[model samples]
Target: MLLARIIKSIVIIIFSCILLKIIQYLLKKLFEFTKFDTRYEKTLCSVLSSISYYIIFVVSLILILREFNIVDVTTFGTLVTGASIVGLIAGVASQSILKDIFNGFFILFEKQIQVGDFIVINEEFRGSVEEIGIRSTSLRDWDLKRITISNGNITSIRNFSKNKMRVVSHVRVSYEEDPMKVIESLEEVCSIMNDKFDEYLLKNSEGKSISEFKVYGVTDIEKNPVGAQYTITGVVESYRYFSASKEVKLQILIVFKKNDIKIAYPTHINVLHYDNDYKNEL
Candidate 1:
């Protein structure tokens, strides 16, 4: 009888594994048929898979208990009822886990964040979201370090990948230079950069690229360095923001050098005088 029960338990475990795989496969096919957003589909499938695993585990454990005469359908409920203290302790211990699961579900259903999104959590831990699980979310930071954060602990999130990001570059020029000339030169550089990085830049509703990049001109005057600060701005896809900003700065330097537009810098002068009486004495 013991050997037979052991074999039945093994068979139950194997069957549960097979059932899980089948469910996963069906889920994949269902998502594919619905044509949902790829990220949303992935999140939903993961959460559902987790839930399925938990259900299967509980069902398999109950079956094994019954096979060994340790517990039956009626006795299981009695045991639970008799262990009120133990149940209360377990419930208290699982409060955080329950909170995490609830918050995770809310995050998924509301579409607040998604896998592959670059976000900053709590104004820190900025990274690309790698996974959104039932209890935690994983992120890959700029340094390539993987960070796992509980969903319940995530208070604020700033998602940068959802829309176009603005790229702003500041250029400083000597106060002596004409603001209009500086603007013209910067505008020319903007045009050149727009053409050079056309593929990375975002377009307007009119299907034109002109509004994508522009020179804002003389945004501020720096007294310490005695220079006029010009602002150049452009809109691009979020992923291309860093590269686009770097390229804009490089192009500004090149254009400014070519146009003899001296960048702002602190200047120091020294003067010495000799008196005629001192000269005669010498």
Candidate 2:
């Protein structure tokens, strides 16, 4: 009887495995058919996959326990009843986990953050969100270090991947250069950028690329030993921001050189008038 029961349990476990696989396959097909595109959809799919595994594991455990006569319906009911009290205490003790879960749900539903988004949390942890679970969110920082933060602990978030990002650049010119001419040159650079890198620029509300680039001329004036600073601001696609900024800066430098615009640089000089007088007296 013991041997037969063992064999039966083995068969049941195998069957459970097959069933779980089938369920997972069906779920995969369903998700594929639904056509998930956004980060939110992908995150939801990951969560659902985890939940389905848990449900299947629990069901299989229950069935296996029943086969071994470890638990009956009456005993299971009693256990569940007793567990409720324990669960209440555990819930109180794990309040942070509960908070994390609540906050995670809010993050998903409200669309505040999502996977693949470059975000900074609490003004300290900056990274691209790799995954968001019920209790914590995973991030990969600029240095490729993995960081995990509890959802409840995320006090602030700065998402850089959403929409177009404003690129603010500064170019310093020597005091001798005409600000008006520099502004014109900068505007020409912006126009050239708009035409040359049109793919990298983003469109405005009117569904046109006309406003994609802007040359806000001479926004800032700084007293530097080298020169005066002029700020140039514009908007571009967030994904290509780094490359776009690099190219823009390079182009600005080239344009300034071509136009004989001298960039500000610090100059130091030393004079020895006393030494010259002593030599003349000698």
Candidate 3:
């Protein structure tokens, strides 16, 4: 009976470990096959794996203890007590940690945003999502600094990177030029820029989703220039290039320079000397 019990114990242990591995592997693969974002999928995989592991470990322990002759009311009670203590510690530590995990999980599972999402949180931090972990999310700030934020603190999320990003360039031309001609030329310039930028290499939010680019017209204005410049608001699409918005703006400047279209600028004029005929001093 002793030998039989030992053999049974060995089989149970081996089976438990194998079961854990299989569960983990399968969970990972299931998410991998979905159309969901990789970061969210990966986070989900880890979370499920961790929970499953603990449950399996606890169950295996109970079974192992039962197989031993030492299994009794006192022994079982002791085991339960020990498990509760460990659980309490973990639970306390995991409160904050779990909030983060929940936030991250909801962000992805609920389709709020993904790893490659270009999001602005609290109207302050704007960047591409570099990583989505259980506790915090990592983002590369505008200055290329890595910013890690707790998921629980994410109050407002502006997902501008998920879809197409609009690049608006308000170009002002001299009123001396024909409004129609300049508008047409500006449109053509924008088209050329769009085509050129199509070939310009750009990085994705997650460094995974690579794309060429697309442009669209937002609006235009041939209205009162502060002095003599007509404002033309040309909005274009730089989808998947929010991170490269700066670069897109630079290209617009280059186009303006090459085309000799003066960009809008505010200026104040002061008449130094009175040139107009005026009575000496009344």
Q: Rate the local accuracy (lDDT) of all candidates.
A: 0.84, 0.77, 0.63
Residue-level error in angstroms, candidate 3, position 178: 3.9
Candidates ranked by lDDT? 1, 2, 3
Evaluation by lDDT, superior candidate among 1 and 3: 1
Candidate 2 off by > 4 Å: 1-29, 50-73, 76-89, 204-207, 222-226, 265-282
Model 3 lDDT on a 0 to 1 scale: 0.63
Better of 1 and 3 by TM-score: 1
lDDT by residue for model 3 over 186-267, one digit each (tens)?
A: 5665565446555333446664324332333323444555424322222323353443456556655776677666655667
Candidate 1 residue lDDT tens string, 193-265? 7887897787667767634789876788744467888998988877787788889988888988898899887
Q: What's the residue-level lDDT of 179 in candidate 2?
A: 84
Q: In candidate 2, which residue pairs clash?
A: none
Kindly report which residue pairs in candidate 1 clash with one another.
Answer: none
Which TM-score value belongs to model 3? 0.53
Minimal lDDT window, size 10, model 1: 78-87
Off by over 4 Å in 3: 1-74, 79-98, 142-144, 173-177, 194-255, 270-282
Candidate closer to the true structure by TM-score (higher is better), 2 or 3: 2
Which of candidates 2 and 3 reaches a greater lDDT?
Answer: 2
TM-score computed on alpha carbons, candidate 2: 0.74
